[model samples]
Target: MDKQKAQIWIARVLVTAVFAINVQCAIQFIAWPESYTYAYQLSGASAEAVVRGYGICFLMWNATYPPVIAAPHRYRVLFIVVIAQQLIGLVGESLLLASLGQAAGLGTLAASITRFIIFDGAGAVLLVIAFALTMRAARSLKEPAE
Candidate 1:
């Protein structure tokens, strides 16, 4: 297969994995909101508000990913947007843990946070590579070998 095709397939596969994970999270939030709230150590009122809003937001944002995966070239801008969101998520999660983890005693949530960091971090890295390859592939078409 060609480099571009390989890159596209790689990105799609990685993105599908991320999508699947998000689906699970959304389902958990929807199907067991109270359980999720307790698992995340959130209070009743706040958990109710957060789970409802954030869960829907998560579903909505994730719903945009399939189009990008289906046609990366057509959705190049969205690819960048996805990359940015992943970075923000990773950094924001780490910052939250760093700033409040100690104070809040987040050790009990190590496994939970670790899974998020791993998946988000991996997804970000894959998308970055895919973007670079896509750019290179596009440029190669415009500038032939010297």
Candidate 2:
């Protein structure tokens, strides 16, 4: 396979992986909010409700991924948006984790937020790599052949 095709494939794979991870999380949160509340040491109906709400927001956020994953070259601009969103999630999660530092009884919540930070950070890196590869492939296609 040619370099451009390979790059596009890699980008698609990366984006798909990220999308799958996010969708899985959303499904779990929505379908079993109680699981998350238990993991985070949260209690009561309000905690489960909040978890479900977060799952809904996650679904809304991930709605942007499908078109781009379907056609990375055509939806190249969305890569930027995806990367920006990943960074935003990473930073926000980090801030929240920091704010919860060393608090007794909130350790589970902090750990859960920390996990999100790691996931978002990794996702951002993958997206950035994919975006670079996609851009390089696009550029190669546009350039005059030697």
Best by TM-score: 2
**Per-residue lDDT of 53-105 in model 2, one digit per residue for the tens?**
98999998899898778767767777678888899999998988888877788
For model 2, the superposed segments whose C-alpha errors exceed 4 Å read 143-146
- In terms of lDDT, model 1 sits at 0.71
| Model 1 root-mean-square deviation | 4.1
Model 1's TM-score against the true structure: 0.77
Q: Show where candidate 1 strays beyond 4 Å.
A: 43-49, 104-106, 109-111, 140-146
Pull out the clashing pairs in model 2. Answer: none
lDDT at 78 for candidate 2? Answer: 77
